[model samples]
Target: MKRYFIILAVLLTGCTKQLTQTNPNQQTAQTFWKTATDAVDGVNSVYGSLMLDGSYMRFTHVVLNTRGDDATSNSPWDQIYNCGKFALNVDGFAASAPFTAYYQGVFRANQVIESVPPIVMDTALKNRVLGQAYFLRGLYYFHLADIYQNVPMPLTIAQSSSDYYARQVSQDTVWMQVISDFTKAATLLPVSYADVTGLDANQFGRATKGAALAYLGKTLLFTKQYAAAAAQFQAVINLGVYSLVPNYHDNFTEQDENNPESIFEVQFSRSVGGTTQGWGPGDPQSNWAKYEARAITFGPRNFAYCDVQPTKALYYEFLQEPTAANQVDPRLYATMFYNTPTMKVYGQSFQATFGVADSEVFCRKYENDGFVASEFVWQFASGINSRLMRYADVLLMYAECLNEEGNTAQAYPYIQQVRARVGLADLATVKPNLTQAQMRDQIAHERFLEFGLEGKRFDDIRRWGWLQDPTKLAWLQARDPEFKTYTTGREYMPIPLAEIEANPGVIQNKGW
Candidate 1:
C-alpha cells in the first residue's frame, strides 16, 4: 500500500507529533530529540513536503500557469478571468484539491518550525533546523502571494480548538516576510552539503545558501526592488561555488544530473525493483520513463501522456523554420525539441514535425533526455534530479538588477558569461550608452530561454507587468487564437470557491 502523508494538520495544529519517527525507548518528543541526528531527520521531513505533498506541482501548474498570459487553453483554470466568480466556481478558479495542497505545504513547514526550537540541541544544529523551516515557509508564502495577491500569513500553528478563522495579510507584508526568511536561510545554510560535492554528485540538487540567495533575489526582482535583488545575486557569484554547465544539454544530461550550475533541485531517485521505486508510482513513473532520451520504460506505445508540449508562441521564439535553419537560437533546440524539418526526432522528419500528420511541435528538451538505450541505460533510469535553481539564473538576475540601477557596464559581463557558455554571441558593448529598456529586454529574454517550463515562465511574465500587454497577449493568441480573446481580468486568479466559502477571511482577487 502507498503511504499517504497527512500534512495539513501539521499546519493547522502546529504539531510535530505526527512527524516524529517512532522510537523504541520513548514514544514522546522528548525521547525523540536525544541527539542532533534525530533533529536533522525531523528537519528533513519538512523538506520532504516538497515531494509527497502535491502542492509544489499543482501550484506551478494551475495557479502560476493560469494567471500568466502565456497560455490559451480554457484549462479548467481559465475561470479566474472568464467567469468573474472569484469566490466560488469549479472549472474557473473555484477551490479544489490544489488549493488545499498549498495550505498543507504551509502547514507542514510551520509544524517543523514550531517543533524544532523547543527541542534542546547544539546551537549550530538548532540553527540549521530552524533555517530550513524558515526557507520552506517563505517558499510557500512566495507562491501564495504570486497567485492570491493578499493572503492570510500564519506564522504559528493553528489548532482546531482555537479560532479556525484568520484574516489575510496585505501582499506587501507577505513579501517582506518572505525576504526575511530567505535572508536568514542564506546566512545559515552551508555553501553545499559535504556528501554531494562537485558537479558529478547529486548534492547540487539539495538546498544551499546559494539557492536561498537566488530565491531572495528573485522575490526582490518580482517586487521591483531591483538594486537590492542584484546585490543578493552578486553574493552568489562571489561565493564561487557554481558555474554554468557548458552545453545547454549538459544541464539536463544524466551524467550531469546535479551539475555545478544547479543551485537547488528537486531530488527524484529512480525505483529499481519492487514498489519502492524512486520516481513515485504509475503515471508519474511512466511519464518519467517515456520523457527520458533513454529506452522507454513502458515501450513507445504505452508511454506516458500529458507531455506538456511547448506552445507555438514558444516554438516561434526558436525561429526553427526552413529559412531560419540553425539561425534559431541554439538554446532553443537545447531547451525544446522541434519536430520541424531541422531538428527531427525518432525517425520523424521535420517537414511533418508540426504539420497535421504529426502534432509534436515542441517537446521539452530538458525533460526529454534524448538518451538512446545502451551502457547509458542508467540515464533513463529514475533518480534524475530536477534543477530548481541554477547559477545561470543568479547571474542573469544580477545583470537585470544592475541594469535597472543603470550599472549596465557591470551587468553586461554577467549576461555575456551565460551566452558564452552556450556558444552564443555576447550582448553589445555596455557603457553608459546602453538603455535600461534594452537591458531589461535582454534579461527577460534570457530568463524566458533559460527557465522555460521549470515553473518560472508565468511568474516572469506576470512580474514583468506584460501580463496584459496587448501585443504580447496578441502574440500568445496568434499562436493559438483561443487565447486572443482572453481578458485582462485574469491578472489575478480567483480564490478557489471552496476556500473562500470555507475561510471567510480569504478575499477573492478582484475581477476574478
Candidate 2:
C-alpha cells in the first residue's frame, strides 16, 4: 500500500535556490556578514546536507554492528554479507551524490568562516556565525576521519588550484585538526542559542559549547587521550542542562530531540508539506512500498534495513534472567523490534518469554511512531533527525574515565545512576574489586544497549581494543552460526583502491 499525503503549500524552495545561486567569491566579506538572515542561510546548508545519506549512513551500522556472525541471515542477504568479509573496496566509500552534498555545506560554512572577519556585524552575531562554521567544519572532519581516514585537511576555502594541491596527512594528523576545530568551537559557542535572546525555549537543535566539548571528549577518547577526554566529558556533565530522558522511548521521539537531554541533534520534521523527498536518494519506487523494508521512507522496516539487523546475541542480552524475568531493559524495547514468529525456530516463540514480535521486528523507537500512512511514506516525505550527542554519552564517558583513573568506587555511583534511569537495579552496589577489563565490559554492554543502531558500535569495539579478539569473534559465532571469521591485524579498514590510485599517498589499512 502506498501512503499519500496532500501538500497544502509549495515545497521549500530556498534549499535548491541557495545551492544553485550561491558563489563564495562574488560577495565582499563586509557585505556578507551584514545580516543575520545570510548567516542563517549559510548554516541552513549544513542542515540540508544531512538529509542526504553519506558514508556514515552505511558503514557505521552495517560493517560495525551487523557484520559479525552473531548477526544472522542466510546466504541470501547481499548488502551486509559483503561487508562481513571486509571485501568492500575503497570505492565503497567513494564520492556518492549523497556524500558530495555535504561538500556544499562545507563550502557554505567556509564562506562564513572566511567572510566574518571583515564584516561589520554586531559582535555577538559575528561570533555566533564563526562558532557555527567551526562546529560544521569539525563535524565534516569527523566524518572524513571515519571514512577516508587520511585525506588532506583543507581548512580555508580553496580559491584556486594552488590551494587544492596539498599533500595527504596521516590519520593522527587528521585527528589533531579535528581536535583543534572543535576546541575553537567550544570557546566561541554559547550554552545554547535563542530564537531571540532572553527566551530560553527558542533554541533550535544547533551547536553549542556543550556540543563542541562532547565531540571533543569522544574524539580524544578515540585517540587514547583518556585523561584529557575524561576532563572534557566532565565539563559537559557539569553543565547541568542535559540529563538522561527517564523514559527510554522519549529520547528517540521527534518531540524529544531538542529537549534538555539532547546536547546536539540533526533536526528533522515530518510532512512539512510538498515533495521535498527528504530521506535522500535510495529507492524512490520502493520508498513508499508496503512490504519493502529497505525503502526507508515508510514501513516499520525503515528501521529494519537489511544492512544493520540487530544481533541475536544482542537480543538475548535483553531477555531478562529468571530473577529479572519481565524486567528487560527499557532500551531493548526501544531499540529493536523482535518478530514472534521469526524467533520460533525452536518451536518456542522468543516473544513468549520476551514479549515482542507479533509479526515484524522494527528498530522503531528512534523513528516516528505517529506516522500515519499518508505522513510516513515517500509521498508524504517526513524526516527523522539523527542524534549527534546526548547527555547520557557524557555521563558514561565520565564514569569510564573515573574508573580508568582508579577511582572505581567514585565511578560506581554514576554507573548506577544510568542503570536506574533505564529500570535496572544497580549491579555494582558497592563497587566490588573490579579489573579494568571487567569495568570496560560493563561499560561496553551499556553502550551497546544505549546506542544500538545509531551507529557507534564498531567505533566502541575498536576503542575498547576488542575488535580483533579471536575469542570474542568465536563467542559471537556461538550465538549465531553465520559470524564471519576474522583474524588479527585485520582491524583497520581497507582503503578503496580507487582512492589509492587517485592519490598515491593514501595507504590501505593492513590485512585488506
For every candidate in turn, the CA RMSD to the true structure comes to 6.4, 7.9
Off by over 4 Å in 2: 1-34, 55-81, 93-105, 195-201, 278-307, 320-326, 339-361, 373-380, 477-501, 504-512
- Where does model 1 exceed 4 Å of error? 1-34, 56-98, 195-204, 272-303, 320-328, 341-360, 368-383, 429-433, 468-472, 479-482
Per-model TM-score, in order, reads: 0.78, 0.78
lDDT of 1 by residue, 217-279 (tens): 989998999988988897888989788876777765456777778787665555422333223
Whole-model lDDT for model 1 versus the true structure? 0.58
lDDT of 2: 0.59
* TM-score of model 2 vs. true structure: 0.78
